[model samples]
Target chain A: MPQQRVVRTIIIADQQGLHLRQAVECAQAAGRYQSQIILVSGERRAENCRSPFEILQLGAGYGAAVTIEATGPDAEQAVEEIAAILSRQTSH
Target chain B: MEIKRGVAVSPGVAIGPAWVLDTEEVRIGERFIATGTYPEEIERFDRAVQAAANEARQIQKTVSERLGEQYGAIFGAHAALIEDPNLRQEVAAQIRDHSFTAEYALSRVIRRRAKILAGLNDRILADRQSDLFDIEKRLLRQLVGQRQAQLQKLSEAAILLAHDLAPSETAQLDRQHVLAFATEAGGRTSHTAIVANALGIPAVVGLGPFLTDVSGGDLVIVDGNRGLLILDPDAETLERYRQAQAAQAGHERELIELRDLPAITRDGVRILLLGNIEFPEEAAQILERGADGVGLYRTEFLYLGRKEDPTEQEHFQAYLKVLRQLPGKPIVIRTLDIGADKFRSAVEPPAQERNPFLGVRSLRLCLHNKSLFRVQLRAILRASAFGDVRIMFPMVSTLAELREAKLLLHDVMDELNEEQVPFNPQIPVGTMIEVPSAALIADLLAKEVNFFSIGTNDLIQYVLAADRTNENVAYLYNASDPAVLRLIEQVVRAAERHGIPVNVCGEMGAEPMYAFVLIGLGLRQLSTPPSAIPELKRLIRSITVEEARRAAQAALQMESAQDITNYLRDQIRRILPEALAV
Candidate 1:
């Protein structure tokens, strides 16, 4: 069996963008996966998906594109979950 | 003796040992560790991180259960950040590679990361740096074994000296042991100041850069009335404060003796002396002080220092508490009167406004956020069924704003009816005559509302165009300014014309000189802090309404605020010499 890597780019759909609470949601979603995940925005990249601090440092604003990259056995699942969090619009 | 001056938020005099709180600026002096102790340093760091993470989780659980999951999630995010594997890796690397102590290594890594977040273009994202700094503080406390001063567990009475106090910290303060407090930072309306006033604790705040000059257990004086913090006072200064404290005690006893008496002028004109309170608990104090009823029950405290907007139930519960405490008494529940900057946690982040006071606040904020307004209106309506609960809209500058607020109140009433919830449909609704425009058009506005509460604090600032908190222009913010006096007079006259009851509910109503002016201006009702009620009663009994009117007329004709102030002082001195002492 070979190691697999998955990458997906998603636009921030929440009106407040990737704020602290949204970043928490992203980190919590990434924490459930076994694969290592990273979020990339512009020139900056957050290597640790489980750290909300790093994810927030990505400074992804509303409608800004963010790239999620994952590797390991559950790389595809990790990418899907993280992308859903980034693309989902939260009313509150 | 060293003296520092700041804004006096609460009134009194206290002499006690200082309990200086350890601020967030924890200096890590020992930067390097022995080469052989790298493993031990890493273990120490790991233990601190574990403890900090556990504390964050505990707070999250408690806060989530109390406030809501939204607020709890804030602490949850902090816990995740505390246990961040990337952060741990960097700290361990610093210790292993550079022989750095855990405290120094952690601070360096956290500061570097926080700086990055702070430098980001996104304002909201940049604000997260505060969370990072908070985490750093928690970690440092654990690593250094320097626990935060347990304000709740103090054994001896002391005056607290701190750089700043979060609302949560101030909420947990054990009032019995805290005789008074002086802070290096805060304004008149800060949570600490409000709590101090509520607790009747002497407090002076916004004394910049004094915490570094003082130490724990050093004798200090918190002269809240004078807004002065004196350190290691000389014998003469100490004797003076001691005598002043004694005089105040005697004066308070004298006032308390008059608590059962009515605030009727010598000419037989009865005046309504109501108490203005921030919390529901203060209702009892108002009754004890012999107030007629609550003139202004500020509802902003419930919304402050919390992560989420208070639920409809929370609002109802708070109003019900006050109503139950003051049964059959008029409780004027002023609808959410906070500026956006004050309650950032409750309100969604609006674009940063340069002038927040003049920006969307109070009734304007309520109108824009209808759900927030609806929830409060529903609560007030529901509470009205229990007792006399009057709803008053704050910062109603225009007739349309007042009408719109009334329309929403009606909407809430309709909803309550549809839901089959019991409430008083005809509950009295009023508007605060705070803005200058509202004061000018009081005649028109009086016809719309059941009553009018003159909020002099905002009215003075708005008319004078001075921010009282800004020291440079604070002198311009005067209640005795002829312009302010004339506007107050106009409002009273307009209210009289419409046969609507009007009262002064700001700080002006609490002061002897200003209260005299207000009485003379034809204000029959005055709402002040409960502690001030007894003294006001004494003043009311001393002078005739006729005399007050004459004094006020003289004041209105004066050219300068200083002249009017001096004239009123002289008049008050002649009538009641003791009132001038306050």
Candidate 2:
């Protein structure tokens, strides 16, 4: 069977954008799934969802739209979790 | 004689060599390397990255352990940014592609990243540029084989002038050499300011771009008392500051001498000098400075920086710590003075009020949250058995509110009695005379409480209809205002009639000059910061109560606040010239 792929466009709603702590949270949440997750915004793409540095390099600040893409058996769950983390307007 | 004004955090004056701390940037020009030396450049960059990572980790660990996990996490963020695979790859690619020096390559790559973060147009995102800059500098220092200027190890005494010092940097400040500090950024309650205060270093912050106007080794005067930084003063000004500095030293010596002496005025009027403290640990400083006891131990600090409401055991432990610290000394523990600026995350106040100052806060909030209030009261009562402890309720406006608070205290006492916990049954209860309503009805209010502590900071601001924190209306918020003095006068008279001891425990009482007026107003007990005790005690001992009484009478008759202020200043200068000098 072809690898299942899930993609979702989500707006970064946190006031601090994809800063270190938030990036770490996203990375931790993404690590729980078996799927490979990637975040993309404009010309920038962070394929290493578990790398906070890569997430920060995306520069996806407040109001910036980013695409969360996942490919695996649990692709749908991975994309939903990562997308929810990015979309939530909270620090904790 | 250029004077830059900032917010005064710690009070004192310092005239010394200026030490400009421009750590944000290191002037490093691009240097070309031979094409064959690309391998060497990459190796150097790799080493620097490793060293920087190690340093970041150490900083994170030490800071987290010392301060808190939240604060220590910043260094972890820095380490993560530094160890970014993309950043390392970009620098290495630059070193190979252009035969550029490692420092230059790293600088360029980091600068580009910072630019990208800045261009995001989000304020919080834009701040990340500083993180980028900090990491870049850390790497560059490691690569260049140079240690970052150690602020903790200054060669000589100097006034530290910086845009700002982080809490970590401020914590490591050499108390012996850095006579004082002035920064371009920070508020009175910022971590740096708080550390500065705790370390007893006079500091002024919020002077914009002070580093730009000052050079290292130039004569600078940091008037922390007035929040003024004078750069390269004229000879006359230098002479003036020198005398002031000398006077400060002399005044300190004089006050230290009087530390073992009682704070009694001439003609045998004994005044009690107490320390207003937040943390129990500060009780030592209070005792060191010769404070008779803790006048006000704000219990609100226990509520801060925690998600969960402090348990009864936690509150009991905290009160126990303060009580044990000052064994037999009187310690007035104000119960949960939260709301109207002081708040805890544990207690969710209703959606932001249109007027929070007048909204449900302080005693009102406590009344609503009976469970929380009861826990605090139980702790206070339990701790009172250990030492001389007094329970004070803050922001009590009405007789009904006071009665309600007392009724709840009675309930807590009954609960403790049923539990068979040993507590001081007669733990002298008091109410802070801060509200205008409380002050106006002091005669009736005085009948209920054991003593009265005039919280003049709020009383003056409230009575004048001005928010002291609001810069625009700050001019109207003067304790010397005739109206404020009259209200204070009313409370003092009421307390006198009831034969209840009244103390002034506010910013007004902290001022040696203003304290003299309070003395004249029949406030025999003054509670201020531990740092101000010596100076206040000296002023008390220098003047007679009769003299302060005359000044108070004249001040009350004055029409304007400015007139009253000027009159008091002149009177203080005449009676205690050394008091004005310090």
Candidate 3:
């Protein structure tokens, strides 16, 4: 089968934006699947989604739209997970 | 004195010279280097980053355990940032192409990253600028060969003034030299605040850049009782504080005078006041404060500040030190209570714990690692030969854990016997009634142990399913909660039925309001930090058993913790207002 890819743009809803906890949750969740997960904020793209440092370095703050892209067997699931984390109102 | 206000985390009065601990700023100016030095510079940068990452990991473990997992994750991000391939590549490329010094290149990259985040035009992204700053500071500190300021090496006893203290740094503070601490940043529930309270020092945090206003070695008074920091007092202010200090000293003198006397209530009921100590050096303070014995000698300190587990000899020597200090006084040596808020890298690798409070720690960790348990047991047994030592297993949730621990103790005793080494064969064995299950089954557990010491700190948390460290659920972590009281009552009643002496060794016993409730619950023995002994003894002496029992009963009947707290506070206020500073 040809490699599947899924991409979705989600606005960061967390009031504190993509801080350590949210970034950690995203990275930790991304680690669950065998997919190449990448987050794009305007021109800056973070391919190392497993590292909270890289995701947070993107500096996608509150209400900032960031694109989540995943390519692999679990591409769709990875996109869903990243989007879910972005849409979550509270990090705690 | 020029006074400033902040949140009072720990209560006391401390007047001393201010030892200002300012964070060192590393200004990395651009320096062009030779072409041949690029590899060496890059290598140097890598080593610094590696060292920084290791430091961050260690800090992360401590912060995670002390604060919460989420708070700990900040350090995780820091470590990641330090080891970020993108960051490393940028600095390496800058050094290779621009011929810049490693520090210069790294600084430039970090500044650009921080600037990007700051310019994000969103609150969340903007706040991350601080995180970048933290990473830069850590890396630079590593590169500059500058160690984190050592609070352990003060020449004289002084009130510490710092911008903010990391939990690890706070843990390193020598209570002898650092009389008190006033931080320019930190909330009431900050790590510094918790550690200050644990160290029994007066502390004021959130003073907002008070460091800039005061010079090092200047006279400063930290009135933690009122959350005030006074700088360079006038004669009248100095006189006032001196008098207050003298009066406080005089009060302590009075309490010390009663040291030789028994802690007897007005009704002629004698109460046993023991000291909860973590180190052998605290024996002097405990004895000076008039404690009957060491109730809880938290042996976890042996496992901290080292890369390797303490040897059998090391453990014995440490126990012997404390044992020798107190010849006649019963020293209840709790065997390695490592878990929850307390962790040792030397004992085991860090596990990703969802809820460490409920995880395998304390006696559970001991049972799992029998050899480690046996070594401590052997040490405790050997130390018992020199002094009145009792071996207590902490965090015993079930009879099985209690049995497993005892069985290991027996094995150690057998091993000692085989080696023909002398040990106290009849050293009293006990288990802490901290876990709610253990509290619920206290009657059953009473059959196995020689005595009971209620660790109310964990008992309250376990009973309420609330993490005491967490600020969000802090309200539910109250010891005055009727549910928590009921559990304490249960443990007390169980001990009573079994004819075993029950003592409270948690912070609850130290607090006046909760102390009243604990006394009323029939806990005649109370162990607390040595600093609290004087005030607590005075409180105990003022109130009769009947009054305490009545107050406890009233507290038990109250539905809400707030109501119970109010009822007890009112009772305490009506009875012995002087015992309580607030």
Screening candidate 2 with a backbone cut-off below 3 angstroms (N, C-alpha, C), the clashing residue pairs are B520-B548
What's the residue-level lDDT of B28 in candidate 1? 83
Question: Which predicted model would earn the best TM-score?
Answer: 2
TM-score of each: 0.67, 0.70, 0.64
Which residue pairs collide in model 1, if any?
none
How are the candidates ranked when ordered by lDDT, highest leading? 1, 2, 3
By lDDT, who's the top model here? Answer: 1
Off by over 4 Å in 3: A1-92, B1-92, B101-103, B109-261, B279-284, B301-311, B336-361, B368-372, B395-401, B435-444, B461-494, B546-567
- Cα displacement (angstroms), candidate 1, residue B477, comes to 3.7
Q: Which should have the higher TM-score, number 1 or number 3? A: 1
Q: Of the pair 2 and 3, which is ahead by lDDT?
A: 2
TM-score of chain A of 3: 0.91
The positional error of residue A86 in candidate 2, measured at the CA in angstroms, is: 18
Q: What C-alpha lDDT values do all the predictions have?
A: 0.84, 0.82, 0.80
Q: Please give the TM-score that candidate 3 achieves against the real structure.
A: 0.64
| Cα deviation of B383, candidate 3, in Å | 2.7
Question: What are the per-residue Cα lDDT tens digits for candidate 3 across B1-582?
Answer: 578999899998888898988666567787888978899989999999999999988878876665434445567766876777778888999999999988888889988887776676655465455566667878888888898655677879999898776555665678889889988767764445665786678999888877878999899999999999999888898889889989988877887777777788999998889999876667787778878889999887677533367898999898888777778999998888876233434455545355656787888887877777777888888888898999888899888878888888898889899999998899999889888889999999999999998898888887788876568988889877888889889889999999999888998888887887888989899999988887788888888999899878877888998888788888888888666534
**Which digits, one per residue and each the tens of the lDDT, describe model 2 over residues B345-434?**
345533335576788778888898888888899899999889999989999999999999999999889988999999999999999999
* Model 1 misplaced stretches (Cα beyond 4 Å): A1-92, B1-47, B53-90, B98-241, B281-288, B301-309, B338-361, B368-371, B397-400, B464-476
Give lDDT tens digits, candidate 1, residues B1-582: 999999999999999999988885678865798888999999999999999999878877865554445455567777888888789999999999999999999989988997887688665555465567668888998998987645688898999888876443564577889999888877774445665775678999889999878889999999999899999999999999999999989988888889888889999999999999876767788878999999999988777544478999999998888888888889899999987545443445443455778998888888888988898888899898999889898999999998999988888888889999998877888889999999989999999999999999999999999989779999999988999999999999999999999999999988888888889999999999998888888889988999999998988899999999889888888888767633
